[model samples]
Target: MTVGPTSSTWTIQTRPPWFFRRVVTNAAAGGSVYLADLVTPRGMTVVVEPAKISFSTVAFNLIVEVDLSGVGRVDDVGIKSDYIGNHGYLSWVELNGTHVVRSPIVLFIASPRT
Candidate 1:
């Protein structure tokens, strides 16, 4: 929803790694769901994918940090079920580690109209 910068430090609540895997796989399978309580720092976008689900998916929750570059952070991030389109960013994140990726916020931009 076009989040603006904030002066406070943003801490994203952790979710079960399986949750992320499911979301990513569902997205790849053309399924959609509401991504609740996701968060990231400002000026960054986090992308998740099924194939890239961490090996610790069933063991430990995957937490990756994004450098804010001194900009405000983004937090309480999520993607609505209706948001699904052009997930190229997810693909990019899957191919590269979060360290190389700048954005730390996840979103589904477009979805099929019901």
Candidate 2:
């Protein structure tokens, strides 16, 4: 999602099923970078548990590992960044399909709407 600082804080959120790689390019004037958070969907709970993110803005190639735990429902994911007050805007967020699986802790069944 194309994003500029929505507020003084540098936090951005996206749709659920957060299994993607995030790339915020053109991070000029001290952009933001922090742990990635998931917005749990209704009827779903955090299963994998969120992971803390550590990113270095020195070069921007630093890879960050974030964990998402949930099932049954899909919700928007909020991303946090250490560097705030950034003049730059957000660029892209790609999902990592390698780990997009149902949580072992929660068993979900999709029900059709009448």
Candidate 3:
């Protein structure tokens, strides 16, 4: 389904506070990583970018990981790479812990549909 900028609801999931902290830390350190949701099969694609104020070459990957405990099945997951430039990477995994699925998370990061 195509999402508009003003859409109130988003399939995008959110992770717990602690886990989010860890993700932030990792991104700040310029680590190329993936954000996974424990509840849902689909998750956000993350890419870390260096901040202008930093001298250590640290980048921030601001991908939000959703919590899917109360949800049901995940049909499909995808992203648009151009949304956040060339650094974004989106992915997902099955809840059964048997399969790893990767897709573009940001759809037209440069031009999100309004």
Candidate 4:
């Protein structure tokens, strides 16, 4: 795990059983995406339920879907539109319904630390 959105906040880093490692704060009358750094693995016991993000520069195509439900296990969710004039083209990412295979899409993990 390695979500991004630094400078204002929005960072998630995990490796093992997906413990806890969070930091997201992009203000602008917008907030709610927290999960401090806990990195579990010693005894393994994590429970973080926090996810709420609404960001869109207005150009279409900025999909973020995070529903960890509990525990840990999120593989291959994609979205990457280099900085330029984005034309939009990332049309799939289903986590609990199958169809998952796309990488390089930064920003958007709403919640996943349980």
Candidate 5:
């Protein structure tokens, strides 16, 4: 599945416990769960890996590792993403590496069956 960011402000919601498990499962299986190809406003596309993913009472935090050193971190912190049927949503996000802190949205659409 594909994921990025969407808008500046996000309305967070609680998700079923199974949701995180599914995401982790997919990632553990060497899938594309954390393959967030975040495109910056400057037209630079960077791939990120989820360093720490955890869901709490009100929202969740996704701390990702960026490939470029000193580029800063990509934090979709205190946000929510959902997986419904074959589609997924990366609703709220923030990239703090740069001073601008652009919000890049990500969509997780399942790949076609081979």
Candidate 6:
């Protein structure tokens, strides 16, 4: 993480994650959940892994701004991430609240149907 003016303003850089992972909100997301409420957050990223993210929070108004360019957004993404970093962007994905972490895919070996 690199430091910048006034200590608070920093330029943090983290190495891309080694393994490919998926991050997403809960499956029971609906009802009052509004995708329009989702704002491009600031300071951090909205992603799962192998992505670069940044963020900075303001203590006064409790406002967060996010930028996740190139990464793009996928609706109903079945993944999880610890990038919450005190930001509400991830939380906004699901109206029920909180996200779930799971393996992107799983392969099951079985005898071929005959």
Top model by lDDT, which number? 2
Instruction: Report model 4's TM-score to 2 decimal places.
Output: 0.19
Cα miss at 54, model 6 (Å)?
30
Model 1 agreement with the true structure over 25-86: per-residue lDDT tens digits: 22222222222233443334443332233332322333333222211212223434553322
Q: List residue ranges in candidate 2 displaced over 4 A.
A: 1-19, 24-26, 30-33, 45-50, 62-110
Q: Model 3: how large is the Cα RMSD against the reference?
A: 16.4
Is 2 or 3 the stronger prediction by lDDT? 2
RMSD of every candidate to native, in Å, equals 15.8, 15.3, 16.4, 15.9, 17.7, 18.2
Which regions of candidate 6 are displaced past 4 Å?
1-13, 17-40, 48-86, 91-114
- Among these predictions, the greatest TM-score belongs to 2
In candidate 1, how many Å is residue 51 off?
14
Compute the lDDT of residue 2 as modeled in candidate 1.
Answer: 11
Q: Put down candidate 3 lDDT per residue, 1-114, tens digits, no spaces.
A: 111221222233333211211132221333233324222223333332211111132454233432222112122234444343222322333233343433332322233346
Model 6, range 1-114, lDDT digits (tens) per residue?
A: 111111222223322312322222223322223121332233323443222222232211112233333222221122334232222322233224353221211111122234
TM-score of every model? 0.18, 0.27, 0.19, 0.19, 0.21, 0.17
Task: Give the range of the ten consecutive residues with the poorest summed lDDT in model 6.
Answer: 1-10
Task: Please give the clash total of every predicted structure, in order.
Answer: 14, 12, 12, 2, 7, 14
lDDT of 5 by residue, 1-114 (tens): 112332333222312111121122211212122223344322123334563233332223344444321111122221223432211222223222211222333322222343
lDDT of 3 at 30: 36
Pairs that collide in candidate 5 are: 2-107, 4-105, 4-106, 5-104, 5-105, 5-106, 6-105
Q: What is the C-alpha local distance difference test score of each model?
A: 0.29, 0.29, 0.28, 0.28, 0.27, 0.26
Error of 4 at 61 (Å): 26
**TM-score comparison, 2 vs 5, better candidate:** 2
